[model samples]
Each structure stands twice: as C-alpha cells, then as structure tokens.
Target: MSGGAQADTAGRHGFTPRARLGLTLIAGGAVANIYYNQPLLGLLVGEFGERAALWVPTASLVGYGLGILGLVPLGDTLSRRSLIIGQTLGLAVALLAAALSPNLACLALSSLVIGILASAAQQAVPFAAELAPDATRGSVVGQVMTGLLTGILLARTASGLVGAQYGWRAVFFAAAVVALGMTGIAAATLPKIPQTRPLRYRALMLSILHLVRSQPVLRRSSLSQGLLFASFNAFWATLALLVEAPPFNLTAAGAGMFGVIGVAGAFVAPLSGRFTDRRGPRPMVVAGALFVVAAFAVLWAGGAWSLIAVGLGVLLIDIGLNAALIANQTRVYALVPSARGRINTVLFTVMFVFGAFGAFAGSQAFLMAGWSGVCAVGILLAGAGFLVNVLEPRGA
Candidate 1:
C-alpha cells in the first residue's frame, strides 16, 4: 500500500475501543442536531400555522446548504478540532435561540443559524475518512454512518415523544444541553490531526468547480447519491400524511414507531461496508439502487399488506441509502485524501440540496396525488439512480 493508504488504514483500524466509541458518540450527537426538527414540524405548525411551520424547516435546510458551501471547506484549511468545537458551540447557541423564540419568525431564523452551524457533522465524516486506512475505508465509514443514521432515525422518535410530553421548546433545550456536553467530549477526546496549508477562500471555492469538471467517480457518485437521498427524503417527508389519514389513523407517537422499524438499516450498513471492501463500490451501488426500486414496488401494493409493505420499504430505503453513501465516501476519500474536507463539502452540499428539494417535492406530491403520487415519484427517482449506476465507468 502507498503511504497515504497506509496512514488511512492505521488511523481507522488502530483506534482503541474507547476512542472508537467516542468518535461514534460525536458523530451521533452532531447528526442529531440536523434531524431534531423533523418530527416536530407538526407541532410547529400547530403553534405557528402551516405556512410558517413549512418555512421554518426550510430555513434550517437553507442554513445547512450554506454551511456545506462555506463552513465545511474550512476542514481543509483549519484545525479540525477547533472547527468542530467552534461550530458545536455556535450550534448550541442557535438551538437555545430557537427554544426561546416567542414567534415563528424568531424560531425560523434560529433554525437557519443552527442548520448552518450544524455542518460540524459534515466535517466529522471527512475526519473519519482521514483516520481510516484505505483498505478498510468503507468499513470505517460504514461504522460511523451507522451512528449517523441512528441519530437521524432515533431523533425523530425522541423529538416527537419529547415534544408531545414536554413541549417543543423543551426539545431544543434538551438538544442544546446535549450539544454542550458533546462539545466538551469532542475537545477532550478527538485526536489532533495535521491541517492543510491555508488557501484563499476564493481559491478553495474554485477547487470544487475543478473537482466537478475533472472527477468522473465524484460526478456519478454524487448524482446517484443525491437522487437516492431525494427519494428517501420524499417518503419520510410525507409519511405523517399517510399515517394520519385513511384506514389507519395513527397518532404522533404511533407514527414515530415506524422509525424503530427503520433502524434495521443501521444494522445492515456494516454488511454493505464489508461488501464494498471485498468487491469494490460498484456492485454494492447497483444492488442498493435495486433495493430502493424494490421498496417502491412494495409500497405501491396497497392494503393491510401496505402497512407491512411500507415498513419493509423503509428498511430497504435506509439500507440502500447508507450503502451507497458509505461506498461513495470511500471512493471519494481515496481520490482526494489531502482534500477530504473539500470533497465532502461538494458531496454533501449536493446531497442536502436534493434532500431539501425532495422534502418540498414530497409535500407537493402529497398535496396533489396523495400516497400514490409519492410512491410514483420515488419509483422514478430510484430508476434514475439505477440508470446512473449503469452508465458509470466499469473499473471505477
């Protein structure tokens, strides 16, 4: 193995068990910040009205989009620990601002700030890439991503239950407290890694354009992952509508139970990583796309079977999404070991942008076509992703 590959493998594989657990916790805490608003959207709507609630979530997403563009690239230029710590502190204050807001506008503005600062989680992924060995990059990324997905899935359930019991304000307060605690842990535990020489901000921004123009794998992987994430977001965004209406009218608590079903994907993520290590990312990418397509088919088959079908579909969607994500990161990290942060900024900027679009499109789809419309759009997106995989260079 080359020196860079050797460093990656040693960094990933050589961690003590305690250190690994700490990294996992950091990943979970950082990612949970982004997802905390998801299940609380309905409550926000009740307090602020539907239009305001709809825009509030978008505010956070818009902030997140900007973070990917502006904040994440700092990983290449500054100390990782300082960047993570500063961002975490900023996020905590933003969450507290959201918690204390007296009106929808105040809350919405805070959400944007929180989302922008929450790019700390994005930085962690590339940090993990830097720490892992080339041979086992997929496995390392998979393990970390397991924590990430757990944070996302469990945050929905936790926020909904907490908001129902305590109130929405309490949800942000608790999140703020957790964020503070995690920031301390990160400062004490995260290892110091070498920083890249400083580049002009404008020059760093231009590098992404160069990456887009030069890298085939980055292009294909980013597009395919973006579409898959859009499809996944489309389902979750509209799920409440499905459960609240028609034959099965589940309460918020009951609807949150589906998040538990989706946790199965976290378990499946490691297998996908192992597959990526052995056979490379392409076969796994193709299989993941197919699994998502299958999920749409199952959801399309309505009835009592529809409930079981949708549950299975959620599992498949989570698995497929995580598999492709880890594989893509593994590949991209290899291509630009020195620029993992910049590469991830480009990758996640696209993913989150599509995710925001998916959420909006799903709502529109639900408003227009209902469950059938949602499923149709998902099928189309999955099919498009599969075609992208087919067109990818064979050896890559």
Candidate 2:
C-alpha cells in the first residue's frame, strides 16, 4: 500500500510497512542533498574559480553538521510529519537556488540551506525508533540506515554522471525535482504524530545536555561511535590520495569506485540489527570494534602493496562501523523514550566532531609516514573503541 492510504491510521496502529519504506526513502533522499556537491566541485571550479572547489563542498558539510545540531531537535517538539514535509519543500527551493546560482556566494549560501534541510534524513532515524516495537527496533533502524548509507555512498557517483553529461546545474535541478516529489510523498506517508515533549526551544536545547549527564549509556555509545567514526574517516580522508599516487596509480574515478565497494557494509546492517536484537547490543558493539581492529591489521599487513588487501580492508571496516552503529544506536534509543531526539543529536554531534579530528589526524599521519601512518590511526581509534566496550562497569 502507498503512504497516502496508510497515513490516517498509522500513528494509532503504529508504523505500517509502506510507512517504514517511506521513512527509508525519505532518509536516503533527504541526506543525499548534502553530498551532491562533492563530485560537482570540478565543474563548479571551472565556472566560479578555485575557491569554489574549497567553499562549495565545505559549506554544504558545515551546514549539515549545524542542521543536525539545530534542526533535528525539533523532532521531539513538533509533529515530525509536518517538519519533514516542510523541510522537503524548503530543500526544493534550496536545490533550485543552487542550480540557478550566478555567483559563488549565492551558490554557497544555497548549498548551506540544502545542507541544513538535509537533517530531515536524521529525523527519519529516531522516528523509526519511536514507532518500532522493542523486539524489532534494531532491525528497523538498520534497514532504514541501509537506505541512508546507500544514498551517501552513491551520491557522488550519481552527481559525477549527471554533471559529466548535462552540466553541474542539472544535478541540482534534478535534485530539486526529486525534493518536490519527496515533499508530496512525505505528506502522504508520514503519520501525524503528536508531540511527546512540550518543552520550548530553549528548554529543549538545554535538555540535551541534561540527557547527556543523566544517561551513561548515551555517553558510552556516543563515545564509542565517535572513536569508530574517527577510524572510518581516517580511511576515507586519505583513500583518494593514497591510491592516486605511485604504486596504485588509480585515477580519481577509480578511487571513487571504492565507495561502491563499501556498499557491502550497508547490506550487512540489517543482519547486524537482527543480531543485536537477539544477543543484545553490547556483544555486537564489541564485535564491531574487533572487526575494525582486524581491518586495520589487514591494511597494515599488506594493504599498501596489494589492491586486494586494500579492498578487503575496506569491506571489513565498513561492516564493522555499520554493525557497531546499529547496535550503538539501538541501545541509545532504548534509553529515555521521550528524549530520543535529543539523544540522537548528542550522538551525531560527537561523531561529527570526532570524524573531523580523524580526517586531520589521518592526513598528518599519511604525510609523515605514508599508508602505515593511516593504518596506525585506524588501529588506535578502533582499539580505543574496543577498550570502551570491554571496560564498561558491568551494569551501570
């Protein structure tokens, strides 16, 4: 059944199959907005000059981080259905603005707005958690995330293809059309959920800090994910540079194809969720960290010399991160039901900050020592994550 047919009763009866699918689609589509500019940077630079390459993608990413911190909290304060539909409508305008931009300033500003609205995707996540039955919540989150991760992994490739054929403007123009369709779909599919917490905006923001102090699981989960993200970003920040030089001699497109290799990780997410449901999130978290640690080991062992080793390491690291993410998120959401939105805010904010540090650290490491430096960075971060899981106080 389509979402329009199901929306009327979905809230009372809980989420429907089509509604879940809608959430997954919304998550993917909305998040894809923040990434569309990456592959179009070359084209942007051609028209707007070198600064476009630096500022365009940077503006979008910064906007996404800010949106997560600012807009995502509204999920707990407002009707999520209304919020999503409104954001999609706004995203449409932003994308259009991007497509028609005559100067870098206008384009950068539009990109910022696009990134801010893109947090609509993150809203779909906790919404899934809110509606899901406890037994299957992990599985649901995993499935939705599979869509999200795929959109992220594929956005660059899609943008490259569109930009190469039709021009960079066409990519944003097409995205605008998609956003309008998403707006309509959201109105049809999203259940009209009443606000659970009635706190004002200021109070709502402050309460996130309160939740942080109050929930140990939230702290640990956020920290573990942060550490793991540091590892994930370390690999990604340096992958293109590593492969494009000497021994590997891969072109940019070839390096980009590694993103496709990471898709295997997304497919494993649902299985991780199922396992977390049965065995509890803790073991999965531990196992995830271990997998990452082992991935770094494989990379350190031979990844620099052998493309096969690098490919295998990519698969393991992605699987580890996604698996840990599903488990960590499941545990965090289960913690204060009324505060899941704020909890998510804290989680993602920490992860983003740590990811930035990882990128910086990995770059420095690669410059100083080469591939081994990158591998060491991954090991240290993943190992720290493993330690966090193991050293938990045994029932806090």
Candidate 3:
C-alpha cells in the first residue's frame, strides 16, 4: 500500500510496511540535501571563483552540525509529523534560495540554511526506532537507514548528472522540487506523533548531558560509531581526488558514479538489521568494524594497483560503515524510550563532528601521503572502533 493509504493504520502501531517505507524515503531526501552540493563544487568554483572551494562545503557542514545540535532535540518535545513536514518546506525554500543565489556569498548562505533544515532527516530516524517493537527494532532501523545511506550516496550522482546537463544551480532547483513534493507526501502520510517529553527546550537540551553521563551503553555506542564514521568520511573526502589523479584520470562525474557502486552497502543494510535481531547488535557492530579494517587494507593496497581495486574498497567501506551505524543506533535507541530523540541528537552530533574532522584530516593526509595516507588513517580508526566494542563493559 502507498504511504497515504496506510498512514492512519500504521500511525497507531508504527511497524506497517508502508509507513516504514515512507519514513525511509523522507529520511533519505532530508539527508541528501546536505550532500547535493559536493559534486557540484567545481561548478560552484567556476561560477563563484576560487573562494567557493574554501567556504561552500564548510558552510553546509557547519550548518548541518548546528542543526543536529539545535533542532534535532526538539523531536522529543514537539509534534514530529508537524515538525518534519514544516522542516521539509523550510528546506525547499532554502534550496530555492540557493538556486536563485546571485553570488557565491548568497549561495553559501542559502546552503547553510539548507543544512540547518536537513536535520529533519534525523527526526525520522529516531521516530522509526521508537515506533518499532523491541524484537524487530534492529530490522526497522536497518531498513530506514538503508534509505538514509542510499540518499547520502545517490545525492552526489543526482547532483553531478543534473549539474552536468544543465548547470550547478539546476541541482538546487531540482532539489527544491523534490523537497516540496516530499513535504506534501509527508504531510499527508506521516502520523501526528505528540511529544514524548514535555520538558522546556532548555531543560531538554541540558538533559542530553545528563543522559550521556549516566548511560555507559550510549557512551560506548556513540564512540564506536563516531570512530567508524570518521573512517568512512575520510575515505569519501579523498575518493574523487584519488580517482581523478594518476592512471585512471576520471572526472567528477566518474567519481559521482561511484555512488552507484556503493549502493551495495545500502542493499545489505536490512540484512544486517535482521542479523542484529537474531544475534545481538554487538556482533554486527563487530562485523562492521572488521569490514572497515579489511576495506582500508584493500584501499591502501589498491592505491598502487587498479581502479577496480579502489572501487572494491569503496564498496566494502560503505557496507561496513552503514552496517555498524544501524547496529549502534538500534542499541542506543533501546537505552531509553522517551529519550530517543535526545539520545539520537547526542549520537549524531558526535558522529557528525567526527565526520567533519575526518573530511579535513583526510584532505591533509591525501595532500601529504596521497591515498595511502588516507587508508592508513581509516585503518587506525576502524581498528579502534573494533577494539572499543571488544572492551565494552560486560553489561554495556
């Protein structure tokens, strides 16, 4: 059934197939907004000049980080369906502004707003967790995240294609259209879920700290995922550069196409969720971390080998990164029922911060030691993530 048809019935139980699919689509689109500008950076630079390279990506990421910190916490204190639909409209406006931007500065500012509104995606994630039954929570998160990861990967491809055929601004224009369409779908289909916690915004924000101090599982899960995500970010930050240089000498379009290959990871997400449901989240987490370590090894070696090897490395890293993400999130959401929003805020805040740093670090590493250096850093991070899981406190 379509999301509109099942909205009323699934609104009560949260596990309806159509509802899950709807939430997944929303999550993906929301996340995609933040990434749509990446593949178009060269076009942005060509239009806006060299300064665009320095600030455009940074503005979006900083805005996204701020959005996660400031806006995502509201999930626990507001009507989620209303909040999500409203934010999608906000994102659409921002995308429109970006498309119409007259100068680099204008585009940068609009991109920042785009990032801020994109936190709406984070809301869908925790909502999916909260709505699912305990026995299949892992599976549900996995399915929802498959959409999120798929969006993250595909945003580049879509942007690259649209920007190449039209112009960079057309990417934003297309995104605006999609956001508006999604807003309508969400407004009609998503259940109107009331606040789980009625605390004032200040208190609710402060409570994230208290929850962090108290929950060892939350701490471990956050740390494990943070490290793994950092590794994942590092690989992506330098991937285009690596593929465009030396023997292969591909264009930005070629780099963006890699997103399609990475879809393999998204395909495995639901299967990982099922595995987490059957065995515990910990094993999948371990498996994910180990997959990262192996992926980095392949990447490091592939730096001197063939493009085929590097593509394999990309596929493996995405799979490992997303699998661990689903498992970590499944465990974290289960820690507190009413507090899922705050917990998610904390989790993603840490992950995003680390991911930002990873992008910067990867750039520096690639500049210094090329792809080999990038792979080394990823290996260490992924290995640390695995070790953290191994050393987790018995109860945690």
Candidate 4:
C-alpha cells in the first residue's frame, strides 16, 4: 500500500487534549523503564560491587536498541493497541523481576527484558502522529516527545531518591508499580486502529531497507539525530560516575539531582515543535547542535572547578538534544505519513544503536581520560552533527 492510502485509511477522529495527555503519559511511562538504572549505577555498585554494576546500564540500553530493531518493525504489521498493551504488561513483569533479583546477574538480565518491552514507547510515538491533524502534527509529536524526555529525566530522580532511601531494589519495585498503573491507563484510553496492508513478515522487515533507500530526508534526519544522540548518551551514561568521583564526591542520590535540573530543559521540546511548525525543522536542528557545542565547552572548562557550570551544561545539553529530537521527528513523520511506525523504527533504531555505542564509549572514556575526555568526545560528536545539518541537501 502507498503511504498516502494508508494515511487516508487512518481517518481523523479529533485528537482532543485528553488523548494527547494520555499519549504523553504512556510514552513517558514506557520510555522511563530503559533509563531507571543510570543514576542508580552508584547504588548498584555499592550493592553488587563495581565489576557487575558497571555493565547493568549498558545491558538495558543494548536491549532497548535490539528491541527497536527487532520488534518496532512489527508495528507496521500488527495491531498497535495490542502491541503497546502487551509490551507495557511485559515491562511490568520485567521490573518486578529486577526488584526481586538475588544478584547483579539476575537484575541485569531482567533489565534487558525491561529494555525490550520498553519499545512500546516507539509504537506510541507514531500512533500519536497518526491521530493528529496535518497542520498541528509537529506540535503533537513535540508534546508526546516532551513526555518521553521528561520521563527519562524523572526516572533518574525517582531512582536516586528511592535507591537512597529504600535501597536499589526499591527503585525497580517502584518502576514496576508505575508500569502496572500505566498499563491500565493505556488499555482504557487508547483507540483501536485497524492494521495496514498485510505483507509477509519477512517482506515487512525488508521494506525497512526499501524505505531507507527511497527517502533522503529519513536518511539525513536519522543520521543527524544518531550522531547527536551519541553525544547525549555519552554525557548521561557517565554522569553518575563523574559526580560520584573525587572532587564532587557525591552519592548515587546526589548524582540524580542533576536529573531534576535536566527537566527544566525539556520545556523546550513543545516550544521547538511549535517553532518548527512555523520556521521549519532544519534551522532548529542547526541551532540545537550549536547549543550542544556550547554545552560541551562549559563542561570542558568547568569539569573540576565549578558545580554551577557543570549544572548549566547539563541543562543546555538537555535543551539542545530535545530540540534537535523534536525537529528531526517532525521531519521524518512528514516524509511518509502512513509509514510512521516503520519510519520511527528506522530512525530510532539507528539513533539508539549509536546510543549504545555512546554509552560504551562514555564508560571507557571515563576510565581512561576522566571528565575532560568525556567532554571532548561530546564536543566532537555534536560538532559533526552540526556539519551534517549544514551540508545535507536542503530539499532533503
């Protein structure tokens, strides 16, 4: 089926404010599962010791990347409502397992399942796209993404506070409860949309490549976001470690305080979306990347000397990344309206694969070169993204 026909089949049914809020909640709640471990790494290190703790965050993120590649494509073939609900339920189960884990190995394994099921967030993003009017689509996407980003930052704060007060396992238990509650909300509120044209499962998978080959905007937007995401992940993956070490000497809970500061930046997503609706996404992409470059400069200069500077850098980084993300997503969703699910899958899969790399690189960079090294890596990645934004064909 052509993208246009598929979009036409998805008849517009007044996406009211209530539905938008519901989608924001669902997306936020689902994506939060994949990030709950970042700030808790220090606590995990205390509980399981460093050797085992070091790999837990990476394991969950790698699992999320795998899920995006493997399960998200199914959105184009399956019932999205059923798929989203099933994944949310699975996430609750995984979180419960993590909460009850007897050892780091068990918890790490459970984290992987948590990550895989968390691809439910991917389905929700495109589903929101399908429901909105064409004129306001970018704004709707931005609002949904705002929820997703807010969830990510809040997960850290919740985990840090919960882990500090009740122990690391309590964080997972809390997450499990949240997931179960979100499942009920999703089941009650989400509308049923009929499936698109049925292709054989193998053919459905291969069409991802066909979409990539045919769409220049998807390729450029995906690559641009991937590079910027690498930098974003690089900072976040090591944030707990950096703050927990020498001059800062903060606990796991303390590391999580930064997440609260990051939340302030998330307000930009909706605004960026509105702006993109008026100004176009490319300009925002360029401006956002420049913000990231400035953020890294702050980190490099203030790594050891000023907590205030580092905090400002964190805020800037979040603002920059969220802006670029909203812009890129706006571009991709417009490219092939009917294929939003597949387009999001391809875009995010590429972005998160690089995210996994960024996480790995952040850890290694911290071990070898310290905070200065980490900032350097972030600067290079964001700079590369800016160059791509400038050089890519404007028509694309």
lDDT of 4 by residue, 112-193 (tens): 9998899888888887787777777778888999898888878777776677688878888888888888888777777777
In order, what is each prediction's RMSD in angstroms? 2.7, 3.5, 3.8, 2.6
The parts of candidate 1 lying over 4 Å away from their true place are 1-15, 42-51, 303-305, 360-370
TM-score of each: 0.91, 0.96, 0.93, 0.90
Choose the strongest candidate by TM-score. 2
Error of 4 at 181 (Å): 1.7
By TM-score, the better pick of 2 and 3 is 2
Candidate 2 structure lDDT: 0.90
User: lDDT of model 2 at residue 138?
Assistant: 92
Query: How many clashing residue pairs appear in each of the predictions shown?
Result: 3, 0, 0, 0
Local error of candidate 1 at residue 253 (angstroms): 3.2
Error of 3 at 12 (Å): 5.5
Model 4 is weakest, by summed lDDT over 10 consecutive residues, at 5-14
Model 1 collision count? 3
Model 3 lDDT tens row, 254-343: 777878989998878888888998988999999999999999998888665588888888788888988898888988887777777889
Error (Å) of candidate 1 at residue 315 is 1.1
Best by lDDT: 2
Q: List where candidate 3 sits over 4 angstroms from the true fold.
A: 1-14
For each candidate, the alpha-carbon lDDT, in order, equals: 0.80, 0.90, 0.85, 0.84
